[model samples]
Target: MTETPIHPWNTPQSTSSSASTGLTPEALEAWVNARLDLHHQALNRVLAETDSRTPGNTLRPYDDAIFELAASSSLIGLLNSVHPDKAVRDAAQAQAQKISQVVVELALNRPVYDALSAIDAAAADPATRHYLDRTLLQYRLAGVDKDEPTRARLKELQDKATLLALTFSRNVQEGGNTVTIDNPSELDGLPPDFLNAHQPAPDGKITLTTDFPDYLPVMTFARSHNLRRRMFLAYNTRAFPQNKQVLVDLLAIRKEIANLLGFSNWANLATADQMMESAANMQAFLDELDSASRDGAEKEYARLLSFSGQSQIDACSRGFWLEQFRRSAFDFDSQSVRPYFPYDRVQQGVLATAARLFQVEFHPAPDASTWHPDVAAFDVFDHGTHSGRFYLDMHPREGKDKWFSAHPLIPGIADHPSGTRIPEAALICNFPGGKPGDPGLMQHSDVVTFFHEFGHLMHALLGGRQRWAGISGIATEGDFVEVPSQMLEEFFRDPALLATFAHHYETGEPIPAELVHKMNRAAAFGRADGVRTQLYYTTCSLKTHTEDPAALDLDQLFHSLYTRFLPYQWIEGNRMYAAFTHLVGYSSNYYTYMYDKVIALDFFAQFSRSNLLDDPIAMKYRRTVLEPGGSLPGKDIVYHFLGRSQSTNAFANWMNEQFQPPSTI
Candidate 1:
């Protein structure tokens, strides 16, 4: 039942190691350079083989190189996002660019592609065959067989693109802005814990940052319109004027690269390797979702305007009005549930729920070193078998990235000479309440987010026990990767499950069922609007990638898209695109959220709603959909789990649930 443990070695044979936890900037740089050297040595071994190519001689070395880069580069890249020291973060960024250059070279390497192409995978296992097929397809997509000059140009352009992306993300990560409130009375409607956290300075001035902990509460609860507007402007404009040009340059470069690769645009090129298949298909999917949710969104907006007795609501006021509407119409105040979800309790609940559903236990790894003292590490055990390790950096701090994401640090490899390489991952988030006295009272949505990100961590660890590192955990199509996260989000609504961990911080009383019902109903009221907003973002992502970037006006496109999908009046000077980090990662495929939502809702429908913890379908889903990793195609994963193609019926029903009587379960 025992799996391999991590070792503190400097060679490629080492299964696992800590991130740049205690390393100085120079040591971190040297560590990355050493890993790159090992990665190159592995690739050189693949090329030096003169005998007949086999999976052993060709694919194994290639995957080992991939494992080397994935194991080290991911952690190094993460430092730029979450590391506390600016000097280390900067060095990590430079090293990250260097790793990207190596990646670009490997993608365009001719001899390596030739060696892999020579492999006869007919006698190999299905996973190995699939791995080889996908690798060759990617090589072809990278134009590996193109002329030397073209490949050289592509390499240069890709390196530039990589640098631009890093610049864009760095701007967002370091671009947090602050707003000052002169009068304490203006903070009315904010929760008491938040007020305590932000007591006025001796000069009688209170300051707030655009970080989510401050931004979400202030936008959703603050009573002052001017304050909300100021916060909104500061938040949406983060990295603005700086990332603006960087995005333009990135798009232009992407378009050029796509043209060189024989695609219409970056959207088409990006989707070529994804589940959506094509940009036109992506548009069709978005159109179907829009048709399904537009009517519901219109009704919800009408009700909101009527409730507010206002002709039009600005962007900053949407959340505030929605909160007010929910309180008045559904008699549910989101704050009422806060005391039941203190950060520590919520963390315990999230871990316990995952353990029960997946049949795994989490043991705290207090001795594990992490980049920051705040990060908590845990070792996962399944039926007495050591599975993997994970870290949770779940609180906000100055100079940290302002986003919630699951980052895979090291890919698990089963055939290492020493033992199985235990996978490692981390969750970087900025939720509320991490201070000594401020019992991080989580919003209901924050709890849902916690569950959602854990879904990804589970996927990484469970699916990581694969033969090929290339198709390991979370290697599924980019569009399909969100299914697990989104599906787990639904579990947060179960009353029986909620009682297991959600309790009052002081009194320890489980949240009442009636209150849970009201919260779900109130939460449901905004479903359509949420969908519409997703569509707007998805379209913006698609349009910017598909259109001519030189002619595209980001501001005008944002305004037009906003009006087209939403009922709210556009706020001037709102530069959301400047901080749209997904543009750097997902490119035009932000529709992945909505697209995967359909599949996720369909998947969740298969579970026994009343007894989700013990449902056999949970394990079935883990095996068929999650453990397969990318060994099977995305469509096959869906079919294997659901016995058919995913349907939109569940999503449609979810959108209209607000109009129906609340579920009695």
Candidate 2:
């Protein structure tokens, strides 16, 4: 039988007036309290009805009810931010945590595991069996196999880790040093609006914040060496005062939790659901990449250093000089590309690419309620059939969530008793907004980011499977999840694809072919240095997570790791780990970026050989990989898609291609 389809937003019946209000803080708190009370009672009722041997059971209904309850609880937490009452907001967070804890408990129970296993074993159909298997894997990953005491401890550790992660991110977002520059010459190569945004002080200095929109331009383009160095240091040194200790404590807790769960290290525990699967493999992969790229990187660094002249090139000046050297050599910079990548046009380009690759249509939905005013929504149609709805929260705001791509609402089996088609999803991003008179254009990097995130958005929305929310889009192995998005990044560089959307914002002229070629050539210039830096982060994460927490001196450990792996010496008191949001979000799975890139390159190779827009290849990709989600093991999906065993050699080849020195003009 085909699995049931359900609307993504269908909610359980709630008689207590569905959380609307003109209520004061106290009344709002009371309303939240009442709802929590009802949910608590309902949960107890469901738990009582669910046991190891319940006959011809009510378990399915019970599970569905619990899922709705959990989703509603999470929604309340999200919506509470918009509440006028602080008390109501606090109450919603507390209540949501409580509900989440309970749901986690139920879902991680042995009985649930046994039931899922039974379903997997007994299901006659492949699809249903795959669904059950995926569900079972999620439970197992959540520590369902642990003894009661261990499970309880794991839950506590996870909860604490979640809260700590949030605190770490919040600290980074709120904390930063601001600088003011008097001379406009210091801001040379910056876009005009960036300069305008910062009001000049009565004394004539223009203020700058560490926000990416402000900082990146200065770092990339500023002519003032001292100013660029200062800004770069400040930007890199966020969360030092507050989050340093937090990182240490969080790392300790994670290590302890991993030990209790029978893993040798936190990396092992975290990577269980990822493609890499262990710290050793990740280390090996990094080591291989480092070995392969070290010569190329050193050569690139030497070329950059030579451009600065021996007398001026010191440790302090190297970074600033290197930036200048790159611009001089490439003759193409981010600012040069921005005019060709206007925000609205890029969105259309992204949608157009999707239309060709996946046979989907996108239409603007300007009326949708969004978290921020700048956010835009769209209705996504499958071959002219309405399939899903998505909102792009593109701009940043005070107290808004930070950078990351997410499906706040994932498409899945709808909760309707009479199954309805499951509408797909929404994607949120924190891209920058442009000021008046200038269209908000993106850099090529930003264009690739749009494509990458949309790749994820499409993965969530287009998967035609029913019944298994576990196997939906990004719900797959963390390491493997990035493959689809990474593959999409290649499209940004494709001339055919770029021709579709890349045009001058004001004049509507196509980006010159010569410019495109230059851009592509320049793309590989700093690749080795870039890849090496990423490897440092990935390696440091693995070391911190795998080591015995009590033995680690967080500062010294990070410093030592950087000194050993990175090309440069470690700076004292540089607490980069403190601001590493990925450590919290991705934890020990940080190596997933490289892991997925390997597969992504392989996938892109296939598209390069075949026509990128070939309908048959696209369908095959959708059927074998995208649609299957977590319904198959990552290895199985990859093998099936490639028709062969996976290899890391492709990653090495891609890196080689990237690190190849630019031919002399």
Candidate 3:
């Protein structure tokens, strides 16, 4: 039986829809089947084309299939992470797995590849030609040209890889462990509201889960070393023991797949299509970052260690000591700025800043139906023409995924037979303050994170209006994807920008420039250490895929890498890899964050600091950097905007900015 189509964005802006009233499990299954049928039909049409291959007869149908499948897969995939109901989430996971399998099978489909190969894209427009070339390259990479038996095996391995990835992520989402405080006094040094909200239960004990809201504050502000240690263990070891084997098996499968594909290792295979080019290149980049940050990291750690009077700062105690050091050295208390960054106001500021910078307007879709009441939907208009829609699911809850990200739910295609398909995206985050009377006083870092994710949302929406769905939105190379997000983070440091939105929750007084200055100075001190930490993760991700999985000791590798890049004494039970969800999606390329940081900083430096929001450069950046999406190669995008190759000089200068004398007002 067929169900009524409920395309994700089909819900009107004025209607309130919850998970209970939204698509049920049965409806989701039927919807998936319907979409898959359309996908198959489109591909079949490509194969059935009797005339010479043109963009319309062949590539158009192929792109249509991709666009349709993405809509089903992306929306259902998001349900697995954010849908409040477990049953819906589980069904979504199953459907997503099924969609993934179909994708793998299509990638290996010989007939479609042959048909696409026949197309003379030389006669087509530049974007269409690029689309064809990229598609052909991807097909070769997917082993569509392999012998029949090899193709079969590759498909099987890829399907298993998909399942393993799902399993690993599900474990992390559902595997949130908790720490219990035996004495309420252990909560001392935490924010007053945090202490109030976490009052002892009837047994006079407080329980904290590994969710970000609970874990971050405890790690940063708690005075009790034992409490911080316990919280760190709980947070780090999430999905441990279980995901350990899962990861090992997944890596082994990836290694085998790489071998079959004639690649040296999974790292080499994964990066082949990206800007990094090769694993050796990735290593060289990481080494440069390591060398650049080494001395500064050492000095920063020594300063923190001396300030704490502890012989060695445990990994768990790093945030605690750093906070104290910032207060003592830079005269900044992170908590002192929290009053000005209530979640709602920070949200307004992010929207306003983006609007002013990008020349867009955001209107609240108050009556829009979302999976949860906490989610806020907004429709975006550029120069008064409706552009796209975005959702803000910005709080934590039981059974929700713990990480923050922007999920593109619907791929926007500019030219479709039915109509122009406008894009839709959501920010799935775990920021504080969604409860009644809980202002969700965000740390300045949280405000930065909000800007970071919104950057992705903007990318998805603005870049979405392309002729082809495959190239629409954040479809750029995997390595280039983080530039927009991280670049937006730099804007959060602007005092004038912060003054526009950061106001005390009760008093409504804007944050003082002096406080903003101190906050930024304190935040800058950790840049080198942050870079080192990223290197540790980047190295771990690279090594895991490059090294043999059968004999690899994950614990030994993790601990060794930590010691190599960080000065913190490693705790015995830290299994951060288990909960490192990036491993599932990013695979062996966690270096993406650091690599893109270099580009992001270079891009940020192009804007005039004094007129950041109103700078003509902002609009130029939107057109040259963000608007192109994946239609152009990343290097081309960078060149068009910055007129040169991206430089690490900007990042290096940023790393040392904390040591530079403060600029006079």
TM-scores of the candidates in the order shown: 0.97, 0.86, 0.97
RMSD of 2: 4.9
Across 209-326, the per-residue lDDT of candidate 1 in tens digits comes to 8888889999999999999999999999999899999999999999999999999899999998888999999999989988988889999999999999999989999999999999
lDDT of 3 by residue, 174-267 (tens): 9999998888889989989898889889998889988888999999999999999999999889999899999999999999999999998999
RMSD of every prediction: 3.0, 4.9, 2.0
Candidate 3 total steric clashes? 2
* Cα shift from native, residue 31, model 2 (Å): 9.7
Query: How high is the lDDT of residue 52 in model 3?
Result: 88
Comparing 1 and 3 by TM-score, which wins?
A: 3
Q: Which of candidates 2 and 3 is the stronger one according to TM-score?
A: 3
lDDT of 2 by residue, 1-665 (tens): 22211211111221123323333444434444554454455445544554543312433444454445534554454534333345545555565555666666665667656655544245245544665555666687778888888888888887787667657876886677687777767787667767776667788888887766677677666767677766766776887778877887898888877788678888888877666777887888888888977887787777876776653343234445555665678786656778889877888888888878887788888765443355567887776667677777665555544464745354355333546435445555555554456577777888898899988877777763445444544566778878888888987886666877899988998888778767876776766776787787888778888877777877787777665655554444466677788888788777778778878888777774326775478777877878776567778888989999667676666666645455521
Ranking by TM-score: 3, 1, 2
Which candidate achieves the best TM-score against the true structure?
Answer: 3
After superposing candidate 3 on the true structure, give the runs of residues whose Cα lies further than 4 Å from its correct spot. Answer: 1-22
Clashes of each: 1, 2, 2
Q: After superposition, how far is residue 562 of candidate 3 from its true place, in Å?
A: 0.8
Residue 521 error, candidate 3, Å: 0.9
Q: What is the lDDT of residue 659 in candidate 2?
A: 52
